[model samples]
Every structure is written in structure tokens, then in C-alpha cells.
Target: MSNNHGRVINFGAGPSALPEPVLEEAAKGLFNFQNTGIGIAEISHRSKEFTSFIANLESLIRKQLDVPPTHEILFTQGGGSNQFSAVVLNMLARWRLLHPEAPAEEAVMDYVVTGSWSKKAMEEAKRLGGGRVNAVADSRQFSQTGKAFDNIPSHDAYKFSRDPALIYYCENETVDGVEFSHEESSPAAFPFQLLGQSTEKQLLPLVADYSSSFMCRPIPRLADHAIVYAGAQKNIGPAGLTVIIARKDCLVDVDAAARLGAAPVPIMLSWKTLSDSKSLYNTPSVLSIYMTGLVLERIDSLGGLKYFEDLNRRKASKVYAAVKEGQDRGVFQKKVKDGSESWMNVVFEVFGEGAEKRFLDGAEKKGMKGLKGHRSVGGIRVSLYNAITEEQVDTLVTYMNDFVAEETKPKAEQ
Candidate 1:
């Protein structure tokens, strides 16, 4: 495939690169899906064809992730940002019902603040104005200074409420480039393994925002989560479509919540509305769903998540190797700790004045783009999403090597 989409090597964070074959197939669907003569975008959401298509899309997610039958896959508008509020409102509803006599102000929602995204989610819970949002484990507490969030807190750092409304976290914090341990046996793996240990009762009311990291690898403890939602802009397809895997119990009724002195859940924001209607509660993002469906089909053709897991591990390894080489030359410094490093987003700091600009300029000249870090934490961020092929990563790594060599050479010798 050619670099017609944008730069030769695209490492943008969200609205990131997509597989070429998926793009071509989606382009065809934009004209016509399944040779139906009508474009997928033009089809009615109420029609049997569209219903069946959405059902298949749900099945595809279930198959790939092995989502338990207790969870229901629902599609909705508004990205993961919308779910931040929805989750609080919905889960608070369940909490109120479970403890009818408890004070509304006493209801706590625990959050593990790893990076900007999880922090923002916590802020939104406070903005909702009902329950208390506690920082169960703020990684910033473990940062070198009190400002930066560059590492995952030790398991002992977390203080989840015994009977909280919900516990929230971002699986991969997109902005600060911190991610949970993908290795199951590692001590740095997911911190909530002990939360739902008892098989006698239900799983803890946990919510995860996997907006940027979803589909890149397999999810650990998939069955134990109350809700896991991802915006389609990153690894799957376009924006405007958010895929949600919600447990049936989390889709509580808003009116019932209000009667129990909890905040009213907005109709559109309610997971129950989408789940009850099979995600056709209103006119959905048809084109985005269609494109994502095409992407999932491509994934299945390529041997599902296992193929991507191995490829992503290799890609991240190469990028990290390049970064380590530059670090040894005193030209770069890795942002996150070793085990907490994100496989999907590699972030680091570049040393020397104008060195960052020079690096970006050199990358641009080589047809590599979107390596700039988030505005708040500026340095370099190379997003290795599922669509970013290993070959593209190699091109960037080679350029990185050349950039380091050029920057570190003795000036007087020249």
C-alpha cells in the first residue's frame, strides 16, 4: 500500500492509522454494503439488513474478546468522554438500589489515576455532582516530583472503598503513555485482581476506559469488569461511535435511581436504553459502525487478536530499543517506568535545546509524521496502534537511529 492516507509513517494517537485493506473495504461499503445497491450510510437503522449487520458486529467483538454471556455489547454515540458521566450515573443507580438507606453524599466512586485520561474521568465524576470520587491510587503520588504521572503505583497503594459506587481506571492512559501490565504473572499486572476474588458474590463495580488501547491486545479479567468502553477512532475505525461492553446489572434505570435520591441519568447516556434497543435506540453512527465492522472482519481474517498481540509486542520492542539507544547517547529519556510502559503509545523526553524540533523536522523529511507528544506533556510520542505495521515502525526506528547519530556526532571533527 502507498502512503496516500497521510505521511509514510503515521504515529498519531487517536484518529490514528487504519489497515489499508479495511480502508478499501470500507470505501466499497460507503458506496454499497454486501452488494445491496444502497450505501451502508444510506440504509435505515430499522431495516432488517442493518439490524443483522449490527448483530454480527456484536458477535465479532464477543468472539474476539471472549466476552462472557453476562455482558451485553452496546453501541452508542459520544466517545469515552460521554461514558465518564454515564458510568457514574448508572452505577450510582445500582448502588442506591443495593443500599436504599445509605446517604447519597456517602456514596464513593474510587479511581486509579494513572494518567491524564483517568484523571479527567475522575474530574467528570465530580462534575456530575452526586457521589464522591476518591483517588484510590494516584500514580502522581509515586512520580519523581508531585506533578508528573510516569509510573503505575504498587498494588499496596490502592485503597478501594469497601462498598463503593464504582471503581474507574483507564486501561491505557493515552496522554501520559502509562499502561497496565499485560503480563499476568508480573507484580505490576492489573491491581484489582483481589477486588472480585470471591466466586460466591458478584464482581466489583469496575469501569475501564480502553479508548486508545482496545483491540490492540487481549483484555485481562474481561469477565470481571462492570463496563469497558472504547472510542472507535484509534485502532478500529472512525470517531462518533463508541463500543461498550456493559454488564446487565450496570444498566440500571434512571427513574428508579432518582426515586432512591440519586441523580437522574440522561436518556441518551443510559446504557440500558442502548442495550434494550439493541443499540438502535436512536439513529446510530451507521458509517462508522460499518467501517469498524470491516476492520473487525479483517482482524478475523488475520487470525484474530493473537496475530495482533505478537505483532504489537514486536513493534513496541523495536521502538523502545531505538529509544534506549538514543538514551544511551544522552539524547533521550524514557517517560514511563520499565514494566509500566505502554505498548500502544511510547513517550519520551528529548535532551538538548531545539533537539525536539530537529527530531520532528528530520522525521517529517523522511515521511514520518504524528510523533509529537500531547500538548500538556511535550516531548515525543510514537503511537504504535494495531494499524501501524511493523514495516512502518522499522522506517521510524531507522530514522531515529540516524537522528541520534547526527545529533551526537563531534562538531569540531566536521
Candidate 2:
């Protein structure tokens, strides 16, 4: 399964596979970034070369995603887990500034919990204790077993709080293979129209965690969101780089808000701090930013988000088709309901005892790996990120079809 350079087809979820060409270029940049003799890892974050590179990285993202002037892109250290706390702290501060006389108990944070990641985010908000946490929609309640992250609750099921401090949702659930449809007409799509109607003359306090599906496609209603963030490792570069797209209004002075009775936000987690210093308030993830810049450049040359969107759509279609075929043959079972399946991660169960093991072993034998599901939920998961090529997906779908055909054969065929 190894390529000429000894690289195997990697399907790992995070710290996942990157483009081969980018890796090759990055290997050179490690020794001499921008021909400055100084390697990217050892270079100073404040240096002109590094700063310019970071600025260009922001520009690339802006151009590709069509981010408007209302938002600012900032990069930092923490992964999405850290943002769980940051979002609650910062958004609550904004709420406090708007309602100086209101008690913290009076403010509510509405969370739409669809899967593992969104549930974790809601839990973090509760733990932070800045405001009351409410689940606008919990997918578990609508699931078959009465408790499972296996579906996207219909739009009608969501119960949004009027003028909540923040309305949160994860764009894609990598672990549970559940995602809201980008199509507004779909029942599984996020109920955007229902938001902001109750609060007149104010922008919606909307936030989304696009950690796993960032850069895979154009975000729907990008301008309406107050904050959208993602960790780089999933679809862009490596770990350590977290990108935040914050609406200008959301970047409030946290210390000032604290003086007004809002919870004190740590300097590092404050969006205003990161925005003011241009994402270099403190030392940044130099290596990750450098590599990500390279990836963004590659993406631009290949026609940007439109190119990857079409490619990713096709890749997911192939994989899902294989899964459907297997299900029809009684060799596989889909985990997520129709219209909620994630284009990034496809989770399903293989039929028969030892059959799952056999599938894994066979895939490994063919040089494909990282197909195992998340530990909390056991099944097979195939992650189709931007870096995974159509040829590679074809290879996987071929294996899946072969496995189904073999599984359906009579045991006496031997």
C-alpha cells in the first residue's frame, strides 16, 4: 500500500494525512523558510518573514471562503477543546456588556447538541458557569434507542432561547458521523431562519465549531455567524494552530466587560487579545502556521474551495455508495440516519462476529489504515478529508465492494 516514497493511504481523523506535494515543500522550508537560512521551527514568531506569511495565510482563507469585512481571522495555540471554554467566556462577556444590570443567572447560552463534539462543548459551557446552559436540540432524544448520537434532530425540534448569550452548534460531528445538511431545504439543516427574529436591531450571537470540516466546503451563511472556529489538524495542517473567524462585534474588550461584572477571562483565551496583537500577542505555533500557509497556497493554485468541494463531494459519494451496497447485501449497517451522514466521516458496522476484524485486517493488508471508529462508539469510520485523493477513495471503495461480495458467499465456498 506504500507509495513510491513509502507513504501509505492514511485515513486517520486528526493529525491526519496531508497533501504529498505540500509535505515535500514543507520539508525544505524546515531548513530554510523563505530562503532565510533559519528553519521555520527555529525562526522567531515576530520576524518579518513569519509575520508576512501569517498575514498571507489569513488573506488566502478570506479569499477562498469569501469572508466579509465584518469578520477578522485570527490564529492561536489551543485546539477546539480550549475554545469550548473561550466561547462561553467571551460570548457571555458580550452578553454582560449588553445587559450590565442582569445577573449571570439571567443570561442563557443555547446549545444545539447533535453529537459527541457538540455535547462536549455544551458540557464545557456548564462547567465554566458563566451563564445558564440550555440544549436547544439534543439528538439523543430523537434517536431510536432513546440515547444515541445517530441523527440530526429535525428543524422543528430545535427550541432556541430568545436573546441567548450565544447559540452554539458543531458544523460536523466527526465521531458520530452526523452532520447538518448544507442545503437549507433539508430537514436536517441548521434552522438559521428561526434565529435572530426575537431580538430586534441586534446580530445573532451565533457560534459554530467547524473543527473537522473546516475548508472542506464554503460555510453556509458565513456572514450571519458571530464566531466560527476550527483546529488546523483536521483538514488543513498539523496540531497547535486554531483559526478563529470572529465578527468584529464579538471581539469585545474582555477586561472592560469584567469590570462591568462579567466573569474575568484569561488573557490567552480572550478574542480581543488575539485580535489586538494580530494573533501574535504571545509566541504562536510557528511551524503549524508555516505548513498551513503552504497548504493554503496549494489550495489556491488548485482553484480553492470550489475544487476541494467538488472533490470531497465525489469522494464521500463513492464511500457512501459502497456502504449502501454493503447494507443492501446484509454485510454492513449504517449508523447515522439518511440526510445526516457526514461527508467527512462515514461510520457503519460490519456484519457478523470477526467480520469487522477481518475487514480491518484485510484493509491493512492492502496498505490502507486508520479506519477504526472512535473509542466511545465502536464501528468502522472512513474519514474523507481534502488530502485524500479520488484514486485513494476508489481503492477503498473497491476493497469495500470486494469485502461485501466475499462476506455474502456461502461458507462452503472454501
Candidate 3:
């Protein structure tokens, strides 16, 4: 094992830190995979080894999440946001197919915009659906912090379910440091009829973008008539490949997934074509698939979803403590909600304008990297993904406190 070299606490939000072992395995496989004399980079995606790899990845995802038989797990290119186009295309096509008599105006999608990614998803859906879209919480803001709204059955959403509108939401916001820990408890389920709704209940399909936090825990029960998608770069294999877990009904939508019938649609956007060939539509990225398999295998060996959730909570708690340590010393304060904060991203802001800049500079000099917050919402963000360690977080905490003390000079200096 290579020493961390004090270069620790890599906190980039997506394409974030991956497990060391996964990286090691990938490095080894670069030259040869499974005794094959060729590098994984050279193997054909259609080769048996690659096929087995893809199958295993799909199986692991399904088994870990306990996704229903009705859901189709697909590996294709395009980030989770691409599903914004995929979902609207497939879903609207189905809606039109189901309610042919309904006016074009009535084919509306209800989106709950909680943060940046959700807003983008809403935009994509509207454009794909051709101006027919309805959004809830079309936007949200945190007041003095503490809570990011209870995702569980908001009074408004539950009330709106009566007549029904196509419901959509981002399961978790990667940028804002908010996550829906439980769909059953989340307002997302409100669009679908609850146990209390009468048998004549009319509910919208509960669609969502489960990108950053997808597969971090067990899949939810009330997520019916839903099409969930994720980008692999964050917690999966790599970028440029988005995985969509669709309820069977959503997969057949022609626009939702480009159908080239084996010819390969543009070599990039054809999800249906990719799914049909088990992701071999053209040549898949072998190293990406191989790394995904090794990662999943490691996850399986560590115990499955139940084990991961506990581990993730612990890691997140450690990161939270680090941020709090900075605050307790008057260096920075968290901006996200108390209980709803994301396990993957911890966001905070320094009190003074120059404070953030000074702290980031110190952190980098101390050997930490990628601690900068995203440009859209800048401050300081520490993304503690699955691979981040408690020791690393502790180091960050220690350094943060020291840096804060160093920066707090007397007013005479000002």
C-alpha cells in the first residue's frame, strides 16, 4: 500500500475519490484482464469476459438495491442529467399512448426543484415534453439553515395527488448537500397514492433523478411508475456512461432511449441500442466496466447495502464533525440542513470574504485537494464519498483548526 503522503481528504463532488483497491486493480488490469494477454483497454466489449463483467455489474446493482422485477437496469452513455431527456421522452410517449384522448396541454410533468441538478432536469423535461410541464417547489431556499424541507409527504404534494400530475424530483441534490434518505418518508411518495388514498385514487408516477446518492442505500418501495438514472463517474464506473433503472414500461419509449435496432445510433446517445446489446452497441470502455466490476465485488465482500449504509453514515458523520470543528473555532459554518445533509457532500462557508480564500490556500499547502466548492454555489465543500477515510477527515479537522487560528490576526493587522 502506498502511503497517503499527507495528500489526503480528496473532496471533489463527482468523479470523486474512488477506493484505492479499485484503482489498484484497474492499474493492474491495464496490461491484462483475467489472464487474457491483452489489456482491458484492448478487449472487445462483446467478448465473453466483458459480457460477464457487464452482467455481474447489473446483477450486483439489482441485488444490492432489491429493485423490483418490473424495473429494467440499463448501462448506457450520458450523465444522469441526460436521463432528463430520456425520462421525458419515454414517459411522455407512454402518457400519450395511454391517454390519447387527453389534450397535449394535459400531458404535464410535475417536478419538484430543490437545487441545481433538479432545476436542470426540469428544464430538460420541459424542452423534451414540448412546453408541457408542471413543477413543484419549482425552486427552494434555505433560511438561516437547519432543515432542507421534510421530503416526506409534504402537505401540498399529498393534496396535489388527487387529480394527478406526472411527478418528478431529484432524489438528492449533489451540489446543495441535501439528500432524501428515505423515499417512503420523502415527499416524493406523496404524488403516489398513500395507504390512506381511496381505492379510486389517481396518482402520478413517481419519477426521480437518483444521481449522487443512488445505490448508497436500498432502493425505496413506493418508487413505482418511476424511472431512475445515475451517472457512473460519481459512485459507479466512469463518466460518459449513465445508468438508467427504469420500470419496464419506461424502457420501451422510443425517444426516452434511442432505438437503432443494433446499428448503433450516433455511437453515443443510443441507450436502447446499447441496452439491447448488453452495452456492446459499439465497443464499450473495457477498463471502465472492469473497474466497475472490481468495485462492486469489493462492495459485495464488505457486505451489501445494509453494510454500506452504516459505513456511509459513519464517514459522513466524521466529515460533519470536521466542519463543525471549524465552526466551533469560528472558522466556518454549514449551509445545508441539519438532518438532511448529504453523506457525499458537506457544504460550509467562512464568515469573512477573505476567510474562504485563506482557508483553501492553507488546505492545499497542507496537501489536501479539491476542497473548493462548485462555482455555481461557491464557498467550501468537502465531498466525502465511499472511499474517504475517517483518519483523512480527522487530519482535515486538525489542519482546519490550525489554519483558522493562523488567519485570525489582530485588527491592528487589518
List the candidates' TM-scores in order.
Answer: 0.97, 0.99, 0.85
Candidate achieving the largest TM-score = 2
Number of backbone collisions per candidate: 0, 0, 6
Better of 1 and 2 by TM-score: 2
Instruction: Give lDDT tens digits, candidate 2, residues 1-414.
Output: 756598789998878999999999999999999989999999999999999999999999999999999999999988999999999999999999999999889899999999999999999998989788999999999989988999999978988888899999999999999998999999999999889664542799999999999999999999999999999998999999999999999999998899998999999999999999999999999999999999999999999999999999999999999999999999999999999999999999999989999999999999999999999998899999999999999999999999999999999983
Candidate 2: misplaced stretches above 4 Å? none
Q: Taking the tens digit of each residue's C-alpha lDDT, what string does model 3 give over 1-414?
A: 126433455778878777887887888888988888878888878778878878888898888888778777777766776677766655655565555566666656667776778778888776655336665553353343423432222435432332333567776777877676564554433334342352222334567777787667765663464577778777766666667777665544354322321111243454455556666776655666678778788888889878778877787887687678778877778876555677777888888768888888888877688888888778888877666666677777788777767656677864
* Reference-based lDDT, residue 236, model 3: 61
Model 3 TM-score, 2 decimals: 0.85
Model 1 alpha-carbon miss at residue 385, Å: 0.5
Q: lDDT at 21 for candidate 2?
A: 91
| Best-to-worst lDDT order | 2, 1, 3
lDDT by candidate, in order shown: 0.88, 0.93, 0.67
Q: Indicate whether candidate 1 or candidate 2 has the larger lDDT.
A: 2
| Candidate 3 residue spans exceeding 4 A from truth | 1-8, 139-165, 183-204, 222-225, 253-275, 404-414
Error of 1 at 261 (Å): 1.3
Worst 10 residues of 3 by lDDT: 256-265
lDDT at residue 46 of model 2 (Cα atoms)? 93
